[model samples]
Target chain A: MESKRIEQLLNKYLNAETTIQEETILSKYFTGLEIAPHLEEYRALFLYYAQSKTEYSTQSIQLKTKKQHWKWISAVASFVLLISVYAGYLYDQNKQAEYAFEHTQDAFQLLSKNLNRGTNAVMYLENYKTATGKVFKELN
Target chain B: MNQAEFLSVVMPFKDKVFRMAKRLLVSIEEAEDATQELYLKLWKNRKKINSYKSIEAFAMTMTKNYCFDRLKSKQASNLSLVHNNYREKGLSLDSKTEISDSVSIVHELITKLPEQQQLIIQMRDIEQYEYEEISEILEIKPTAVRVALSRARKTVREQLIKQHNYGIKEN
Candidate 1:
């Protein structure tokens, strides 16, 4: 195509007025082995576009691999979080049980001490009763 | 869709996604990060995405938003300059030797433009997206997309011509 025609097409391209066929023609023109000196600057841009397609860099793949590892790490972290929460709950329950056992033991100790004191008072009263009965028989 | 179905649907667009991210971020590393992030975002918001007419548009928008969010946060932290320099260094190291000098120059110039213009060029030129689709992805009027694209292409062409002359003079 002539320079003027190409320029016109380029203008149309800029205005988004070019049809797909025209775009394909423009792309073909730019990709041709021969390009004008003035239009050389645009050759790269068009060529880049023509060549621009989906590409995956090895580095990107590596990054993706690392991301996969991170997913596993995050999953593990979540599992650990759950386990920690459960352990904390179990710890609280054990503490409550221990507290209840200690209180029960204290209450039982208090009852046994009072029962022994009551028995000792009863024994002293029994000795006094026996001594008073002997004194009444001697008087008769 | 299920994971396999979603992956198959999106697998065809991986290059498109990569190019979009590469254009937006100007770094392969950042682009790769952005791609994975975009995919994760898609997976997270897959429910809402069913309403979208074009999954490609949806993915592109998500990628753009993610890149802008990172840029904004970096700016807010006052680390934009430092981060930019660091990114430049990384890009230099990871630059594709296969790409021609003109392509590299064009890519660099595109990065110099405002984000909106850059995005418009990418959508129209690189991705071959229609004006209506671009509008939907950008949430702008279709006319606005055309106008921005025209101005962006003009600027790019101008820059390319100037750079070409400078190179000839240097030679």
Candidate 2:
């Protein structure tokens, strides 16, 4: 009589019509040692299901908490700030060097132009001296 | 929600997520990684986490989709939907010795099942989810879930019986 009931429950179970309670009953019936020989094949299936349920993940979950997130964000932010600051310093240094170079070039150009003017005055004085010598020679 | 509250709400189903991932993924490490990834995603989106009707169902669906994508991706070339993690926990040496072979055979047969069928079996038989919950996770109608589950159960039953008979014949 118990076997007959289990057969009906198993049929319902196979058809996906069994309620959770009835399925539990079927599982219980299958797990027992006195299951009929014909129904014995299903023992492995039910046992496997029960065993599968027990198989929890052995690994622990590691969530990056908000504090950690902030830690990382701040770390990255500081690194970026450091890089940009160093880059700007390098750029400013370069610009200062460039400015000094241009001013030096202008000063040199001005000095050379003034020196050329003095040379021109000296050349004019030489010409005047030669002309004076020729006039004095003429007078002699 | 705060991280603590979010974790309190979501951590209850972490094992379920891992188990479902293990169902779809090949290795325990892969499943663990997938679980962690899913949780990280949920944690990132925690501001909107409470907007969902059921976070557990959402997580399961995400796990299923993530695992399927992983399986289809290029790295999944070496990965197969093999249920090799059927462990024998807390059982006596005698019973473990008896059921180990049959349990492994059932594990092999489960892996041989079709993709949808395998999910249905895992969700229904192993995980003991209701039809509506299974439908929600798999995004199928309850009727379709029932039909697929029935088909999967019948297939496993047929294959398992055949294997059992074959073993008897060999003995």
Candidate 3:
């Protein structure tokens, strides 16, 4: 409290012999508004420290990298998902086309077989007409 | 730890980290950047945060290392001409300028000290760290820390007295 005692503490502080509590006393002493004239020179140093303690990072913290990385991963994942969905769609379309073509081929083969039978039947009928006319001619 | 937990654990000392960085660095912007970078790192290593006895000390050590590395960079040296430039709003212009001048003088005198002493003062006086904590941050013996801090404060005190007596660098 007294300048004499403060001076003693300050000396101890300069020697780094003071305990943490004692050092706090010195810091608190120098920090007051009314410093003794002889000790005024030391005021700025303590004031600077006190002033610095008040200095803080007012800018809001933005830990962007981690969030950005997760965003990037999601983007890539969605991109892969889109590609897979498109690929699956294309594969399904291809299978449906192949199945329909196979059915059409089977139906065309059946149609051609029946058409061949019809052709053979017409040929037999034509031969029968010609033979029947010949027999008629012979009879005539 | 997760963001909320990491923030709760480390947020209390973020300003302390900022001040430490500000002390080492020449500019508030650089200090702010360093503080953010330090927290980002702490966040990344949040899982390991519990391993250290005191997260604030760990953060201060990280801040010290980061700022020192920054000081070595060409840009930081260029920026060293600037120091704390904040204002006490209600003061008259003359006293404001006077206080600012005195503040810069102490700050400049501080910057000229050997880097170790300057760091010790910052840790001991400005940051008010425990001797053990300062020792851990500086990676030195507690006795050595006390010696360095003594030397640092004496140098500043003598220079300040000389300046006040003769007005040598006042212009």
Candidate 4:
């Protein structure tokens, strides 16, 4: 295609007016080793598109390394958090059990004191009843 | 998406992802970091992504935003490193002779453009994304995408011509 036509197409391309097929044509045109001198500046831009695809770099390895480091750090942090929460829960349960045990012991002690007082009172009443019976027999 | 599905779709696009990062951030190291970060983000939110149409665009958008955030942070710190690094390595092509150095030059020039223009070039030329997809990715009207791309192309073309003329004069 003539340079003028190509320039027109390039203009259209810049305007986003070209179709995918037109883009392919432009890509092919620019890929040639020999481009017109005036249009040579655009050669790099189009050629880059035509020939350039993605390629992995050593930087990607670095990225992976950093990622792995962060992943481990995050995992460790989460594990510690879980452990801390579980320990807190266990501590709370133990405290509740201790309080319940102390309350039960206090209740038992109170019950024992009441039983001892009742036994003493019963003994005293029995002795008084025996005296009263002896006095009634004498009066008779 | 499941992890495996996400991996299958995104793994192939790593280089593209990296290139976009590199183009936007102007640093290989930072670009690699961005790519990994982008992937991790996508993995974390895999369930929210419903279709491929939005997936690629969303990834690109994430990359753009991430780069922008980095840029802003760098600026806030008053760190001269980012712009200095760009100046030092402006238009430096990789060691692949199969691709012309001019491509790198164009890429460098593209980096100097505003964020919107740079993104349009990335999607339309480099990624071969459709106009509608570019529009969606940018959240701009399709017509706006076309106009921005056209303007960006003209700018790059002018810079290339200037450089070419300088080269010819020196020779």
Best by lDDT: 2
lDDT of 3 by residue, B1-171 (tens): 678887888888878787777666656677788988897888888888899998888888888888878767745467433332422221232254456777667877887888788778877787778899899888889999988888887888899998888774655
lDDT of 1 by residue, B1-171 (tens): 777776777777777777777776666677887887777777777677678888888887787788888778767899667767766764575365466777767767777899999888877776778788889888899988888888888888889889988989999
Question: lDDT at B28 for candidate 2?
Answer: 68
Interface root-mean-square deviation for each candidate? 3.5, 0.9, 1.3, 3.3
- The TM-score between candidate 1 and the true structure equals 0.72
For candidate 2, the TM-score is 0.77
TM-score of chain A of each: 0.50, 0.58, 0.59, 0.49
Between candidates 2 and 4, name the one with more favorable lDDT.
2
A5-55 per-residue lDDT for model 3 (tens digits): 989988988898888788777778888887888888888887777776776
Q: Give the 10-residue window scoring lowest on summed lDDT in candidate 1 chain A.
A: A55-64
- lDDT of each residue in A1-140, candidate 2, tens digit only: 89999999988888999988888898888877899988889998888888788877777777865777899999999999999999999999999999999999999999999999999999999999999999999999
Which residue pairs in candidate 4 have backbone atoms (N, alpha carbon, C) closer than 3 angstroms, thus clashing?
none
DockQ of each: 0.35, 0.62, 0.52, 0.29
lDDT tens string, model 2, B10-125?
99998889888877775667888899999999988898888999999999999999998987883456533243232322223226546677876787788888888898888888
Q: Which ten residues in a row have the lowest lDDT in candidate 3 chain A?
A: A47-56
Write down the DockQ of candidate 1: 0.35
lDDT-wise, the better of 1 and 2 is: 2
The per-model lDDT (C-alpha) reads: 0.78, 0.84, 0.80, 0.77
Tens digit of per-residue lDDT, candidate 4, span B22-127: 7777767778788878887877777777755667788877888888898788789987966787656533445444455677777567778998898788877878
TM-score to true structure, per model: 0.72, 0.77, 0.68, 0.68
Off by over 4 Å in 2: A65-140, B75-99
